[model samples]
Target: MNAAQLRAAARARAQRWLRDRGYLVERLTPDELRYMTSWSDAPIPAGQPVPQRDDPRLVALRRRYDELDWPVTAHSRWSDRSFVDFARFRGDSLYIWHYRESPRVSALKYFMFLRYVEERDHKGWLDALGEDGAFGCWTFEFPGRRPVSRDLLDSVNELTFLDRHLQLSGWDGLRALDIGAGYGRLAHRAAQALPGLRDWCCADAVAESTYLCEHYLQYRGVVPPARVVELPDVPSLAPGAFDLAVNAHVFSECPREAVRWWAEQLARLGVNWLFVVPNEADGFFTHEADGSRRDYREVLEQGGYRLVVDEPAFADPAVRELLRVHDRHCLFERDRP
Candidate 1:
């Protein structure tokens, strides 16, 4: 399908998703909507050309994401419950920032315990950063039950494996690259969580994400540590210069060719370790709009990468065991002879 057809399908899907979720369905007070629409780097609205997609479905989904349009409006799905949760997390985060703890920090381990599905863990923020003065952040769903946002949680969780299992530490000291990094979340986390982290690259296939991350990292004061590497620049980087590379969120939504591109790119880039959270039920796979499946395992193997770490989303046994739904995360290492 062409761009117009793709846009229409995306519009129908997003409108249905928002409407069904009662998003944009009501007005809210300023306090109730404090962080909702307050994001400075929110994406452009839908019906706009998105960063140029090579795949029609990807274009449609990117359009859909814009339609979801976060820094959610009061009229959007900013629920009273979500407001309470966000406020509570923010309050605790601020307290943690001050190196003071809140009782809410403890309550975080139990919040939304059932929805521990997807990359988002089921709770609030609890852990303080090892980095001085960086304070508390909401991170880590694996080895579950931390008081942090899903994004942060996912970052810490992914990093923990590298830290504890792979014997990698201080991301600043290593050559690091993040593929498909959106808005520089991991970059922010690495800067915050690993104060010693020296060099990091935030690369994305999406033009909007690449642009947003470039600005977002600077806005978050993590610019030098987390530089945005645009798609066109990927080929220019020195090969075998990266020790680790990360991919999160929507990678599983990629088509076969996209997966191959990533694999081949990482292989050529000489990245040793590949970390991903594919969101597949059992194994690494991406399903097409037509129900065809592309198992990324095949692509990775063909690229001379192999799975080394595989487990439930959470590192904590209890968190993984207590999960109402199961999601697995896998780590792959590039081992070309």
Candidate 2:
């Protein structure tokens, strides 16, 4: 058979195999196929081992976390097993990239995202918040910039997007609450980027996350403006204390009940705006520990929040597809009583 005939035969066989396995095969253009396969050649980094010496602070934090009687939903994937290494909490544990993502690919995504920001960063926030590989985070140096990480790029992208919607630049005395604030990544960035930000409170149901957030914000020396609110203390926050609430890649990791609980808190606190970055591209869904997905949008709405904006994390569809980053940035406003 000619080469073309042989290729056809192989395609047929592959399709047959997929069908037998209860999979649907879709045809793709060469460019589309190239985009999908481009990451295959990217190199994966070696895994770093957890340090032997445990910090006494982390141990105390863990004790505090263990003492609390958390609901089952709050004890999902993050608390189920040792997902984070306290010693290297900022590395791959919080905002993980090394395990399921390629370093080179992630760098490309960050570079593209930087380009996107450069066009809109009239205030030079990106330059102000340039990243260093502090706390063992993975870093890549993009062109004309210092070392950058997913934590930095994602935080800046989110901030810029939020600014566009909420005019955050002009909002003086803005108080923000971060739910599932892992390692205080966004909290640190938001504090630096928005000088008018009165306070940025980092809260998390996971004890390790709270511990790291508390340590990281102080380690970065933004503790006055940015503070970690332990799970127990979150309820005590007075109504209307915060103007905005952000939950990035957080609700998706939580169970439905946990999402509902958080939504209720936001409603009770009278937070006017909510920002969520779900893992899904098109829907608001929760990722359960048992590898199941449940819709959490209704839970938020039940708590009197309504979706105001839903946009792709990467505005350019081509860039989003090429980078394989399809997260959606969702903003919602709480309905007044």
Candidate 3:
């Protein structure tokens, strides 16, 4: 089935599952629907997107998130549930940042996020700098209750640009290095996408994430011991190790100085293509509070890399919703600069 069909099928299944569990499903209006669309669907909302304190629903959701550790299955994906879960994992320390202080638009946001996850079929985040103060201290959790890798692999194909580049530029035959490959979602999908890709490495600074990847690989029974790396050897690693390097959610959450260092290392890796991901508006917080969001244009420019093409946001419905909630990933490539 096509992306739209797959999305509809997944939504139907999810809605049915939610209904069976006694959750009400509300049909979204056009405006509400738009909000759940990809970040590129609409222009970035004007200043201070945070809901007002007087807003009862927003206030209630925020209060619940702040006070209670709610069940992940109970709340909507977009609802305060995500924020609460995130806050639980990350701690309330980020609340000190005024922009992140806003109550999450839980219900709407969760719908978008889950859809994106389903569509994209993977949750990609950058590897932290092995520092406690980075990336909100959110632990990587893979809901690997079942074999969902195929579902995610199909979802990533919605990006015409990425698919095209892989086919046209011979990325199909290369080895892949997924930096900060949270839960091996992207790495798994990449493997599924390109049959000729013989070797794949899912590297992250966290041992927990690597463990999850190993588990996933074991479950799939592809590689006896899949390349799940947990080390700080990006800088001095063997040269030309992988043909493609994907840094999802890595540049933004890592320390600013570290981002530059990683960039240089990636450059030296001599990879044919590099994918640097960051969220749309709330990358390092809701409003650039931590300055984690790297300027892709600047980073590439300074690294002396040429931009082949850029995908503003994903077009897959499910992928788009994911963008709304967690990230708005864009792809950049440089070949033989």
Candidate 4:
């Protein structure tokens, strides 16, 4: 097929896939497509506004997460209410604020993560992870509640390309670390591919995610050698620990100071490669000075990291419903020593 034909085919396929999944897909201007809130009980609108029953998965999640008795709180288990919960709670308002503007994306992302968590638990990954594991998100305590079909697909594609790119670049034995290891989904996938990693740690500033990882490891019956740490002013990681440090779509929402602090921490961690996945042309945080968005590259570089790999975006089946339209690209090795 010619370029135009190919593009047309992809668009058709995308629209069909979205419709099959109950999204109302429409082509707006050539550059953008707007997915408004659907009145339908769909966690996200399949199209613009309409009425439908709430999704069963969403109902289950709300029943579980919204309950005051579900689990941890300031008054609940101290260990349960760890730094992870604190951070998430702190971010909850911010996230909610953003959700008003992009409820569909937020809701879908949350739903997919929960789904993945539930699936992993059903697979016994959670039991294998042991008692140390706990859930990370403020919305739901399980990964299964979050919908991530497009995100995962996009992640897999990005990883596939990254593997090839790194292979061509003589990148081998590259030890790595992941901050904000939400439910350990992305890190788990990366571990499956990057065999050369000598030392790798999946970390989150929050204890909840670490706890969840432990649970997930149990469910999967896999013993993890690395443990999660409290995200410090500087991470208490071993010096020269990894060749790569990655945060997928993590830094974008983080405060500027936090981003700078983490970048410096990564530099101290001795990683030569830094990878970040964010929306291609936009970020979560906004600026009042010029009503502009944060620049990923600029902030990281200012904090002492360099971009080594910048690749175009690809669609992920998990998030295809949410992000198939925009330029949601992934960047690898964004920060280099």
Candidate 5:
């Protein structure tokens, strides 16, 4: 066979191999092929291996988590039985920090970081908090900046966004509550960022989350300002104690009932302001583990919170599109009294 015929035969075989593996094969132009090849060759950093299930600490936390009477939706995605990877909480299990270490993803995150720095100009402030890559987190070094991980970038961005909306920087003796406070990521950052922050309560329905939050905040040496409030203990919090409440990428993962329960609790606590970062960009929806969605905005509204601010996670449209980040920063205020 001639050279062109041999090339066609090789392409056919490649397409067939892909088809057998359930991938739809398509003809790729030179540029597309190069992009695909680069992505395939991207280096994925090694993460901490999952710890043994029977680790005494994990066993204790799991027992505590199982003891709670969680709302059906609350346990959907965060239960002990289904979510057994909590041991890698700091690495990639709970809050994602490792997967973005690949070349393409890291570059996009760096650009997003640049956009955040340009808009907020809080790079120095964030750098001060430091990124030591504790507990097997993935860290990346950007030019002219201190080492950083998704934890640092995301926490600083969210905190700066909250400061912009709520004036957290100027609020003296500001008390805040974190709903679904996984490993106290925001709590530690907020405690460091807001010296005037009187009390930062980290609350989570997942027992393992509560366990990790307590340990993580203490490890970061923010225990005096940051404390973990178990789901059951949340009801004991005094009303009007917290000036603001923050939920990052949490409501979208909860069930409708769980969302309602949290809204009710926040209302009962008389938290004046609520800042939520939903996984959805255009609408308020709950993402159930069973692959279902339900509108949760009405639940919060019925609980007396009114939507006041709804903006893209990244203020710049170009940055948003380039990073493919559709998350939104939503701020709500209590409607009554």
Candidate 6:
């Protein structure tokens, strides 16, 4: 089929799949649910009068973060409120003030270290993003190594770090799916990096995020093969059985239902490869968003996937051994059903 025909099929299949999964499409319309609010809230339209920059709530949240010794604790507990929460927080307001704009030390340090600090090669990779502050990232001059823009850096690092394993030969007709794809940061990078890709689907559970990603992908010129798939439509829109399915720093934050559901979806799609990254150490344990603790391995096994490669998010062998406690990045290959 022609490219237009292919896109039409994907759009229709995706919408049909979402409706079957019980998501309310009418609610997603801008006239209805305008903005995303919280993890539990459905998409809703912004109130007629949006808050101005100087709004008291905005000032208060900014103050709350600014005053913190750290936006997240080194202990990395969910209750301590790690970057995991910040990434998945329900509303556009929370992300805008706390992440996209705020330069509080706590926010800066938290975003910086998790991916960039240990991943030494990221320095050269970041050149594509331009001056740090230009992208809402505040830079600190650290001797030898510098970390910047938590989400953006991490997104690029994941693609490059994992490149050793994906062995992407060409972008032509290549397909990818990113689950819990926050703001399409990786999608933006992938569009520029992977020139031949035929389809790159960004899926997220938050309605507010769907609105944001659609515009973000377009703004970043990732459309054609790069498109936002409403979270529920995941099962139907495999797009040539997605060459890679990414669950970057996301699965661990999911509830038991969500974790298992995503596992099964990727398995059902027969995806060739799966990438998993987390905010914590080497063990399989994760305290899910649903308040349930789980070992993500169980979900992977249930979905018929197997661990093929395990490595630190940072590639240095000495560093991996030195930092023995943390298990940051992993690859799981589907065990052909």
Candidate 6 C-alpha lDDT tens digits along 1-337: 9999999898888888998999744324452232222232233234422223344544454454344442121112223322323223323322322232223333444444444444554434555542233223233344444444444455566766566667553446788888877667677767766667777788865444455566557755669778987544555674356888887766666555566777767877888788888656665655554465678787787888888887776565554454342447788887764
> What are the lDDT scores of the predictions, listed in order?
0.56, 0.77, 0.46, 0.46, 0.76, 0.57
Could you give candidate 1's per-residue lDDT for residues 116-156 as a string of tens digits?
33333222212543221111233223355333354444556
Worst 10 residues of 2 by lDDT: 39-48
Write candidate 5's Cα lDDT for 3-47 as tens digits.
999999999999899999999767667744554443122232366
Determine the backbone clash count of candidate 3.
Answer: 14
1-337 per-residue lDDT for model 4 (tens digits): 8999999999999989999999986544422222233211113223322211244532443344434331121111112332332212212322111232254455555455334433433323323322211122223223432322332433454455555545512455666677766555555545444445444477654444455554443444333433344333234577787766767655654445445566667667666667676644444341222334555466667666655555444334544444343434444343342
Q: Where does model 6 exceed 4 Å of error?
A: 1-124, 129-135, 139-148, 169-171, 315-327
Please give the ranking of all candidate structures by lDDT, highest first, separated by commas: 2, 5, 6, 1, 3, 4
Model 5 vs. true fold: TM: 0.80
TM-score of each: 0.59, 0.80, 0.49, 0.49, 0.80, 0.60
Query: lDDT of model 5 at residue 12?
Result: 95
lDDT (Cα) of model 4: 0.46
Per candidate, the number of residue pairs that clash is: 20, 0, 14, 61, 0, 9
- Model 1: residues >4 Å from true position, as ranges? 1-147, 170-172, 289-291, 315-325
Off by over 4 Å in 4: 1-152, 168-172, 225-227, 232-234, 280-293, 315-337
Per-residue CA lDDT of model 2 for 1-337, tens digit only, reads 9999999999999999999999978886774554344422222335533333266766776677777765523555565545565555556553655322434555666677668767777778777888766656656665577766677778877888988899897889999999989888898998888889899999888766777787778878898789988777777999979999999988888888888888888888999999999888888888676778899999999999999899998888887887787888899988886
Query: Among all windows of ten consecutive residues in candidate 4, which has the lowest summed lDDT?
Result: 70-79
Error of 5 at 164 (Å): 1.1
